[model samples]
Target: MDVIGGKWKALILWELENYGVRRFGELRRGLPGVSEKMLIQQLRELEEDGIVTREVYREVPPRVEYQLTELGTALNRALEPLGDWGRDRIERIGANRVHPVTT
Candidate 1:
């Protein structure tokens, strides 16, 4: 759970899954709220965990892209049902009440 647990990791994975391959700038743009430092940290962790692959291109400006590994693909697939359930629960509770007050 730790490998993919967090606010941004799963979202990052989902984005990669949807887009196939994404560059650093692309991911940064896609996730508007995530800071560059946090994104880099998360990507590094994911790469170290073998859930993501990073490729670099040799060029003047340089280019780097990220993709999900086999393990990452399986993990994302396994979480599909969980994602669906969350969506349903959110709808049932209403988006504005997703985090209701607790006293």
Candidate 2:
């Protein structure tokens, strides 16, 4: 869990896995609630962990994109069952959220 245990890490992985290569801005837009700083931090962490690859293109504006490494893809595959359990959990407990939390 150390590598992909953060709040936004798994979602980031899921997004990249499902959508393929993504630029920083595209990743920000794809994940609706993530702030710019958080996204950058998460991406850097993922890259350092060898779960993501960052490609830099020298151009007029300097284009950069991120994709999963082979290890990352395999990790994502391993997360499939966890994702399924989360979805099932949501369905199972969705009704419990009918009331807003007071705190």
Candidate 3:
């Protein structure tokens, strides 16, 4: 739970899995609600956990992109069923949105 815990981690993995390699700005743009600091921290932790790879290129402006490692790919695949379950629950909850009167 620790490795892929929190609001941002799973979303981050989803973006990389769907989009392939992405730069810092691309990640920020993809995840609209995430702040810069939170994104940086999440990426660092993911990298440290060997879930993502960060590559830097030398240039006038430094370029860095992140992609999932092999282990990360496997983990993401494992989570696909969880995603489907969550989506089903979301639909069910939405259908049952009417609340009962409380005493």
lDDT string for model 1 (29-55, tens) is: 988899999999999999999999999
lDDT of 2 by residue, 1-103 (tens): 8899778999999999999999999999999999999999999999999999999999979999999999999999999999999999897677658854566
Q: Give the distance in Å from residue 12's predicted Cα in candidate 2 to where it truly belongs.
A: 0.5
On the 0 to 100 scale, the lDDT of residue 2 in model 3 is: 91
Show the colliding residue pairs in model 1.
Answer: none
- Tens digits of per-residue lDDT, candidate 3, 1-103, equal 9999999999999999999999999999999999999999999999999999999999769999999999899999999999999999888777777653356
What global local distance difference test value does model 2 have?
A: 0.94
Report lDDT (CA) for all predictions. Answer: 0.93, 0.94, 0.96
User: What is the lDDT, from 0 to 100, of the residue 40 in candidate 3?
Assistant: 99
Summing lDDT over every window of 10 consecutive residues in candidate 1, give the lowest-scoring window. Answer: 92-101
By TM-score, highest first, what's the ranking?
Answer: 3, 2, 1
Q: What is the lDDT of candidate 1?
A: 0.93
